[model samples]
Target chain A: MPETIRDPADPRLDPYARMRERDLVGRSGRFVAEGEVTLRLLLGPRARFRAESVLLAPERWPGLAGALAACPAPPPVYLADKAVMSAVTGFPIHRGVLAVGLRGAEPEPGALVPPPPAPVLVLGLAGLTNHDNVGAAFRNAAAFGADAVLLDGPSCDPLYRKSIRVSAGAALIQPFARLGPGRDWLALAETLGLETLALSPGGAGGLDGPDLPTRALLILGTEGPGLEAGLLARARALRIAMAPGFDSLNVATAAGIALHALARAQGRLVPRGPNRGGG
Target chain B: MPETIRDPADPRLDPYARMRERDLVGRSGRFVAEGEVTLRLLLGPRARFRAESVLLAPERWPGLAGALAACPAPPPVYLADKAVMSAVTGFPIHRGVLAVGLRGAEPEPGALVPPPPAPVLVLGLAGLTNHDNVGAAFRNAAAFGADAVLLDGPSCDPLYRKSIRVSAGAALIQPFARLGPGRDWLALAETLGLETLALSPGGAGGLDGPDLPTRALLILGTEGPGLEAGLLARARALRIAMAPGFDSLNVATAAGIALHALARAQGRLVPRGPNRGGG
Candidate 1:
C-alpha cells in the first residue's frame, strides 16, 4: 500500500514542493516529472532514470496500480488531496501526477559520441538555452534516431521540470550529456568524426544538396541570434529551403525538419506501426 | 511622441491589463501580442491585424522607434516602467513588449479553401485546442506557404495570447477560419476538391508516397486522442517515417514535417537562393 500524506509540508516532499524549475534541475541529479504522460515516459524501458518517489492525487492512485506493480522495485507513492497538492506545489497541478526521479550516472560527452568512419546521426546544441526547445529537440532526436544529444553551456538543463514535461519526457529517456563549462563544441564534434552540418536560414547548401555525409553532427544554435559566427564558420552551413520572406522556422521545428531529412538520407528513419488508421 | 503613463491603471490600457487570456481571445476580435519578436511580426507590412494599442516597458520604447513610426496609423504606444507594467499585468513580463491587435474581418472557411482543380497546400486543425500547438501550426502554415488553415469545433483560439506568441505572429497574418460547429470537417474538405490526408501514427502511406495531389488538405488532431474515429475513417491516412519505439512527434513538429513533405510534393515549396551563411 502507498503512503497517505495529509500534510502539504512534509519535509520528505521537498523534491516535489514549491521550488522553482531552475532550482530543481541538475540539483544532485534529481528532477521532477509532471503529468501522467511524462510519468509513464520516466518508467519507459530505455529510461536512464530511477524514480525516487511519487506525489500523486488520490484519484490517480487507483488508476496507476498496474503501472506501479510493473516497476522493477516500486517506489514510494504519496497520496495528497487536491487542496494539499495546490498548497504544496504553489499552484494547482491539474494533471495531479508528479514524480521525483534521480538520473543514473551519464557518460561524459566524449565517451558516448562515436569516433570517425562510423555511420551515425547526432544532434549538438550550442547555446540553445530554452528548456522547452531543449526538450523538444531531444524528443525530435529520439523520433529521428539520433545516437545522442550533446549540449554546451549556457544551455538550459533538459531535465528542468517544464522541459521534462515539454519533450513529453523525451529528455529523461533520450541519451544526453553536457559538453562542458568551456569547450570548442564544434572542434570536439569534428574530433569525434562528425561532419558538422550547421542548420541556418541562409546557407551554402540545401538540405537535399549533394552527398550529405553518412556520419553527420547537426548543430543548432539559439533561436534569435542563431549559431555563433565562429561556429557557423567552422561547420559546413546547410539550409532548409523554406518559403521566401520568412526568416526561419522555430528552432525546435527547424530541428525536426533538418533531423527528418538527415535521418532519412543516412538510412536511419523507417516507417513504423500497423501502417493504417481506420475506425 | 509615445504616451508616457505614470499610472498602470490608465483608462487607455485595459486591453493590456490582467484579463484572463480566455476572456481576451476573440472577444470582439482583439488579441494580445507578447514578446519583442511577435510584436514586430504584428507590425509586419503584410499583417492582417491592426495594432489597437501597445504597452511597452520603458527600456524597450527607444528601440521600437522605427517600427512605431512605420505603423500605417501608429496606435498609442503606452510607456510604463517595469514596476507599473508588473502591477498592471500582475506579473513580471521580462520581455516588456505586449500589444493588443484587432484582426480584420475574416473570410468564410469555404472561401479561403482551394477549389478542386487548383494547385495548393493547406492545413486543417480538427480539435487542436492547445494554444501553443495551434500557434505553432499557424507558424508552420506560413513557413510552408499553406493557402489557409481550418479549425473545427473544440479547438482553442489561435488568437489567444500564447498562440500568437508561439506562432511568432503567424496567427495575425496567416488566413484561418472556423469550420462548422456541427458539419463533418472531412466531408467539407472532400467537397472542396482536397484530397484529405489525415496525419496519424498508424497511417499507411509514407509521407513521401506517390501522387501527393496538388490540392491537398492535411488534417491534424490533438496530440493524445487523435482524429476522431469518424474523421479518420473519412480520410486517407498519412504518416511520417520515424525511428522505432516512439509513439509520435509533438503536434507542432508533426505539422512541420507533414507540411514540408506535402508542400514539397505539391511543388509548393521551392528551395530559396544564395544558400550562404557567413560570420
Candidate 2:
C-alpha cells in the first residue's frame, strides 16, 4: 500500500513547491514529470532516467501500481487528496499525478557524432530560450529519428519540467548533450565530418528538394535574430520556401518540416508501417 | 494628430475591457489586433479585412506614423499613456499597440472548393478547440498558399484576439469560412469535386509521399480521441510515419508537415522569392 500523506508542508514535498519553470531544481539533474502520460513514461521510456518517487491523487493510485511495481527497486508512492496536493504544490495539481526523476549523465557533445562508416543525423539547437519551443523541437527530432540532439548558446534544460511534459517525455529518452564553453561546435562538426545545414528565413539555398549529405548536422537558431551572422554564413544556409506577403512559420513548425524532409532524404523517416503514403 | 485618451471607464473602452476570448465580439466580423506586427498586418495585408480604428501608447506613435499615414483613408488612432492603457484593458498592455478591424463576409464552406477550372487546396478543420492550434493551422495555410480554410464542429472564432495574435495576424489575411448547421462536409467535398483526406495516426495510408490531387480537402481532427470514428471512416485516412516508441507529434507541428507535403505535391508551395527549395 502507498503512504497516505496528510500534511502539505511535509519536507518530502519540496519538489512540488511553487515550481515555476524558472525555479525548477532540474539544474541538479533531477526533474519533475506531471500527468499520467509523463509519469508512465518515467517508468519505461527505454532510457536511463530513474524515477525517485511519485505523488498521486488518490483516484489514480490503483491504475499506476503495476507500472510502479515493475521497477527493479520500487519507488515510494505518496497519495494525497486534491486539496492537500494543491496546498503542497502551491498551485492546482490538475494532472492528478507527478513523478520526480534523476536523469543519467549526458555524454560529451562531440562524442554523439558517430565515427566513420555509420551515417548520422544530429540536431544542433542554439539560443532556443523558450521551453515550449525546445520541447517541441525535441519531439520533432524524436519523430524523425535523429540520432542525437546537442544544445548550445543559451538553450533551456530539456529536463525542465515543462519541457519534459511538452515533449511527451521524448526529452527523457532521446540521446542528448549540452555543449558549454568546453565544447566548440565549429571544431566539433569539422572533426565529425558533418555537412552543417543552418535554417534561415533568407538564404541563397532553398530547403525543399535537397540532396542531403549522409552525415548532416541540422542546426536551428534563435527565434528572432536567428543564428549568429557568422554561423549562418559559415554553414550551408537553407530557407523554407515561404509564400510571399506572410510572416515566417512558427519556429517549432518550421523545424518539423525541415526535419521531415531531412529525415526522408537520409532514409531515416521511411515506413515503419506498411501503409506509409508518399506525401 | 491622434486623439488622446486618459479615462479607463470611457465608453470607447468597451471593446478592450475584460476581454476573455469567449466574450470577444469578433463574431460580428470585427476583431482586435494586438502587438505591432498584427496591427501592421491589419493596415496592409493583401486581404479584405479593414482597420476600423487603432489604439496606441503615446511612445509608439512616432515609429508607426508611416504605416498609418499610408492608409488611403486613415482610421482614427487613439493614443494613451501606459498606465491608462493598462487600466483600460485590465492587464499589462506591454505590446503598446492595438487595432480593431472588420473582416469581410465569409462565403459558404463549399464556395472555397474551386468551381470547374482552377485547382484548389483547402484545409477543413474539425473539433479543434484550442486557439493556438487554430491560429497555427491558419498561419501554415497562408504560408503554403492554401486557397482557403473551413472550420466545423464547434471550432472557436478565428478572429478571437488570442487567435489573431497567435496566428501572427495570418488569421486576418487567410480566406476562411465557418460551416453552419445545415452544411455537411462530406456532401460539400463531393459537390466541390474535392477528394477528402483525413489525418489520423492509425490511418490506412502513410502521409510521406503522395501525388495529391489538385483539388483536395485535407481535414484535421482533435488532438486526442481524434476525428469522429464515422468521419474517419468516411474520409481517405492518412498517417504520418512516426518513430517506433515516441508519442505522436503536436497537432500544429503535424499540420505544418502535412500541409507542406500536400502543398508541395500540388505545386501550391512554389516560392515567391529566389531561394525556393522544393521539399
Which number leads on lDDT? 1
Candidate 1 docks at the CAPRI level of: medium
Candidate 1's DockQ:
0.52
lDDT of 1 by residue, B1-279 (tens): 888888877888776677564454445667788888788878878677888988888889889979989878888888888788888877787888888888678678878876667787879997787888998999999988888998887888888877887888888778888887677766777678778988888787787678787888888988778887777777888878888777659998999998888877777666755644441
- Stretches > 4 Å off in candidate 1: A6-14, A21-26, A80-90, A114-118, A275-279, B1-3, B7-10, B21-26, B55-62, B76-90, B93-96, B114-116, B273-279
**DockQ (Cα-based) per candidate?**
0.52, 0.45
lDDT of 2 by residue, B31-100 (tens): 7789988877777736558888889999999999899998777888999887888887777888789877
For all candidates in order, the CA lDDT equals: 0.81, 0.79
lDDT of 1 by residue, A1-279 (tens): 888899888987877777564464455668888888788877667777899998888999888877888888778999988788888878787888889999778678767766766678889888887888988998899889888898887888888877887888888778888886677767777678778888887677777665998888888988777887788888888877666665558888999999998888887777655744541
- TM-score of each predicted structure versus truth: 0.91, 0.94
In model 1, what are the clashing residue pairs, if there are any? A203-B275, A203-B276, A204-B275
**Predictions in order: chain A TM-score:** 0.92, 0.90
Which candidate number has the best TM-score?
A: 2
